[model samples]
Structure formats: structure tokens, C-alpha cells
Target: MPELLSPRIDAISFRQLRLFESVGRLCSVRRGSEECNLSQPAVTQSLAKLEQMIGVELFERRPSGSYLTPLGRILYSRVVRMLKQMVTALFELEVPGGQVGAEAIVHRLTRSQVRSLVAIIEHGTFAAAAAALQITEGSLQRAARDLECNLRKNILFRSADGVIVTPAGIACGRRMSLALQEIDWAINEIDVARDIGESRIVIGALPFGGSVLLASMLDEFLATQSKVDVRIATESTSEMMQLLRDGKVDLVIGLTQETVGDDLVSQTLAETPYEVVARRGHPLTGQSHVNHEDLIKYDWVVGMPNSNRRNCFDRLFIDGPKPRTPIATSALLFIRHLLAGSNRLTLMTSYELQHETMLVRVPIDVPLPCPTIGITTRADWLPTALHRDFINLIKSRVNTRSIMGVTRTAA
Candidate 1:
């Protein structure tokens, strides 16, 4: 059996892991340096140290740029998952009481190294974690080193194959996530103990969460419950749901019908159908007899693959000799911008179209399917009094479909 790359490894700081993530993702030294706000030499040095610590060349560096090796890709995926969990852990709230006991473990780590490790485990990588914390890669590296010394153990396992959490490191990481949550909860509980009613509610929502359908509910809730605190977080579907489940936020508002797993409970709020749209004055805007071939003549911008609207667009355009291949595929904002400028046409949720004034609905003669949008909660956990009220408010205000099949009532 190949010995696990566990013990022989000294500590690698989260900062170095972050540097690796940046180089791996951006695939350019200069670009990664700019994003990480580290000097070129500094980022290079960190990467070198990280590679040496790990004993594998994670990247194939050429004059043109850097590319992830096979091992690098595998490591990147795991790092992303770790970062997501850590971020969620940070927002967790602890039980109200005296501070939890800080166990003195033998690990070689620094304060920066600990922070960097926690940030990376929470946020997914050096670039993303750095971006979220608003710090430099070099600084993060230094901190990670400090944490290792404090802990008296090598918390991060570095190798040419990529960095990972050793058994001890994984145990430590889990504690960090949990303790952070407890700390947050303790702070909130202290506020309550002091007879302070200033409770903050955070809601993680999908891209459409900020739209008119949900926006009105938020406005109404704020007007009535002025004393309650509200913070809205916008992210992709997976990120928002993950955050919700981790207890990083109070609730998640968005499409929550069939996609949620068995461990989640979903509630229907509204039904939204896809509408084929174009710029205000596009040539084919008002044509009643338009076909897929005619639609394919224009440049197209579609949603990212696997997205409901993107899949719908593909299905609608598949009959023609040459399907309307997307020039670019991304989030709704990008699709809207492309549609608002050039002769591009793409699918938009009715809610999205309602928000953008520069777009006009291009009525498709055939059927374009509808997708339901709502909220979800973990089946195992119950929401607090405030979150439940917020959920109810969402249920109440989403009743305005004023439009036809475009907006319908959902569970």
C-alpha cells in the first residue's frame, strides 16, 4: 500500500493553497497575482514552497500560462468543497455562554495559516477566500504559518499532487467550522441576554431572488418588522442551498421545487415560464410567423449548460439544420446584456424580463416550459420564529401573477 502522504509533510499554510488555487484557476501568473494582490515574485515563491512541501508539480507552467495537471484538478475539486463548508461554518451561531475551551494541541501553525486554512476550507480556494476576506495572498500565507506554530501541528498537507487535510487536519477543520458557528451563536445570544431585540436574519437566494417577485415581499417585511435585521445573499443555486443547509444563513429563497434532495423540505411560491426575448427594436421582435431558422440567424446568448432556460432553448432550437449555438453561456445578467445590445435572442424567466426595461418578449408560437421557484429548508432543522415569519411573508406577497401563464401560483 502506498503510504498516505500524512506524517512526513511539515505544514503548508492555507495561503499557499490559495496561491495554488489562483494559479490553477486563472492559468496565468500575472493574472493570478493581480487577483490575489501579491507581488509576482511573492506569489511565485509561495507556489514554489507549496509545491516543494507537497513534492509534486501541480501545474504545467509554460511561457504562455499555467495549466492544472491531472492531480491538480482532483485537488482543486476537493478544495472547492472544503471552502464551501468553511464559509458556511463562519456564519453559524453558538450557544449563549462563556467562551468554549481552547484545547492546546501540538501542531506547527501560525494565526495567518489558521485563518487562511479556515477561509480556504470555507470559501473554496485562495483566490475566492482572499476575495471574500479582502486580504493579500502573501499576508494570508504568513498568517497560515503563524497558525501552524500556535497549533503545534502541520494542519495542511501539501504535495505535488495537491494539498489535503490529514486525518488530524480534517478533525481540526471540523472543529473550526463548528466552533466558529458556536461563536457566532454565542454573540447573538449575548445580545438577547442583554435585553437587546436586535435579531438579524440572513436569507440566501438564487439569482432570481432579488427580482420583483421576491423583492416586494422583502420590502413589505421591512416596513412592518423594522426592528428585525435582514441581510440578503445572492449566489448560484448550489451555493445558496449549500449555505442554507450549513446554517450559514437563516433561509434560502428561490427555485426549490423538484431539485432539492430527500433531506430538504421545499415550499412552492410561484410558477415561472421561459420567454424568448430580444432587444427592444430588433427586426424580429413583432413577427408572428417566425421559425427556428429565422431565430438562428441572429447571434445568441444562452444560460449556462444544465440550467432550465438553457435546456429549454436547446430543445426549442434543435429541429433546424443548424441549431442556435450560444456565442456565450452564463448567468441571467450576461444573457440580458447580450440581448439588450446586439441582434441576439435568448430565453428569460418572466420575472427577469419584468426587471429589464430594454428587453421585449419575442412570442414563440410553440410551447416554452415553465419552472417553479420557491424556498427550501433542511428537513432535520426547524426555522426560528423570525425565519418562519419571513417565510410566511414570502408566501403572502408572491400572489401577484397579474400576468398570464408567465406567472402562476406554485406550492
Candidate 2:
């Protein structure tokens, strides 16, 4: 994407976006004029003005007809999605017994102003935010000031330390962020609609799910939807939750926990039973029975502190003295390597240790509690068609038959 310079966001209207979309779809300005019920000259002028506002040549005018340039295709996709959403919103407002005359509260601020407010809130400093947005400090400050004046509230204040968002400002910024997400989602939706080979999804996964569960499902999804791009991040639950709230990730998959905040929605897919695993040649590998007392003697390798696996491990030994200091990490490959080369034990779901011939599960009669593994997404998120399809594929891959016998535990 390029840095779009102004005529200001207010200059760009829904009408212009709609016209552009029609022209791009039909590949003829005359047909677009007919579709939009405007004269051909008016449609052509509106498109020219839109291009000038965004500082991009949306189409190439040849003898045959007007064909979209690369930038035009991008703009057309976004416009179509935005128009669809606007129509949907209007329909929702017009539902029976609904507030018939209700309309969106018009703000005096421009899109750039709202974007500036959100950027400042996210970056925490005017200079840094301006740099990120490719705008000058003066312009950003003026936009922020204009926003505060329009809202009739002090959105930000300068402190000795730095600029701080006021309580009201925080609330406003959150709404703006969500609105920005809607715009982004509109673009993603259009990409999916065009089948342009550029759709994308970002997923955050915990250690176990990323390594075992998501790995297989993603392979299947990509094989069929090869045009869709997928990026995966493995991080702690808290960190991933923050990313989800910030709209940096589309969804998260992992063991479910009671600590999840109200902003997220979780659906249990399956129950994953855990095992105490050690290197194949470790002293405890072939033992007839392994108890907590016997397991405490060896050094241990565990997930990062406060992680689901680590917390469960701690609870299993709550009555006994704490085991010797263990190597703490979240990297599965590193854990596998450490366990293979040293006298250490680690707890893992059977799925996690499935392909590792160097590691073996210690035979123990004591039943360790199983955790419910599932998918988590933002409560207010509206998925595009592709996103919904991908989610369905994941659900199909979950082994529902095994969930009944496993004991669920709070992580």
C-alpha cells in the first residue's frame, strides 16, 4: 500500500467509492454512469476527482474502454466491500420494530483525524506516531486537536513524562480502532471476493496447538486455498490476547483457560490428555511405574512460567517441596533437544510427542488432568467468507470422539 496524501478524507465520499466500484467492475465509464444513474461526464469527473484525492491513477483510458490500473483494482476492491457493509448497516437499522430513522452519528472529524488519534494512542507519542503514519508532527498534532475540539473533550494531555490519553480519549480511541478494523476487513473481504490470489489471515497459536494441531490443518487449508496467505505466531496466552485485542491477529488456538477476558470468545474443540515425557534412554523411560515422588528426583524442563502446562505441572506437585530449578522455555524444538541430550523430564500432550522417536512417555497409572484445547477469537469479530471456511476446516479436523473420556482441567 502507498501513503495516500490529501484533499483530506472528508473530500472522499461514499458516492465516489460506489461509482469507482461500478466503473471498475463494468470496465466502462458509460456503463458505470448508467448503473449509478449519473451522466457519463459526471461519472468521469467524479472518478478523476477521486483519483486526485487519493493521488493515484485509478484507470488507464484507452480507445477501447477504461481499464483499472493496479491501484484502481486495489481501490475498487475496498470500495465494493465498504459499500456492501454500509448497505448492511442501513438494512439492520431498518429492521421491523427497530429505530427506523436512526442513523450513524456524524462526526465533524475526518478519517485522517480518527486515524491520527488511533495512531497516537497505539504508539504513545506524537513524534513516533507521525513517523509511523508518514506525516509531519505539526499535521498530526493539528489533526488530534481538531478531533478533540469536534468531540468537545480533552482527548489527550501533555504530562512531564509524555503525552497521555485521557479516560474519554481511551474510549474514543478504542472505537476508532474498531472502525479501522472494519475498514481493513472490508479490504480483506474484497480480496476474497475477487479471488485475486492475495487474501491473508494471521493466526496466533500456543506451543502445543501451533506445533501439533494447527500444523496439520493449515497444510490442508493451504493445499486447497492456495491463493490465501497464512501467517502464524507462537506466543504466550497473555501476549496473544493482547495481539487479538489490538487487531494484530485474526484468531488464537490453544488450551482454554478460565483467565480469558470477556473480550474474547472461546470454543472447546477437543480435550488433550498430557503425558510425562523423557528422552528414550533416560532412567525413567522404561520404569514400570512413575509417581510424583520418583519424578521429582530428576531435573525438569518446563514451559514458560504461568503457561498452561507449567501451571498444571505446579499443581501436580503442590503438596511436595518444589522440584529443583528447571530449564524454562516455550520453544518445542529446544525442549526436544534438551530432553534428548540430558536427564530431564517434561510434560506434553501425546500429540506433541507423536513424531519424536528420541522421546518416550513415562508409563504412569496416575491420571494427569487433561486441558480443553480450542479456538479463540475476538467477540465482536465478523469473519470474511474465507475466514469462516478456514475455521470450518479446522473444526472438521478435531477428533470429537476422544473428548468424552478426557477430564477437563482449568489451566
**Each candidate: what lDDT?**
0.61, 0.71
Using lDDT as the measure, the top candidate is 2
Query: Model 1, residue 274: what's the lDDT?
Result: 74
How far is 349's C-alpha from truth in model 1 (Å)?
1.6
| Residues 96-192 of candidate 2: C-alpha lDDT, one tens digit per residue | 2333321222213367777788888888899989998889999999988886665545668889978778765665566556544554554444445
Q: How do the residues 116-170 of candidate 1 rate in per-residue lDDT, one tens digit apiece? A: 6767677655567778667886676666666655544566677665554455554
- What is the lDDT, from 0 to 100, of the residue 135 in candidate 1? 86
- For candidate 1, what is the lDDT? 0.61
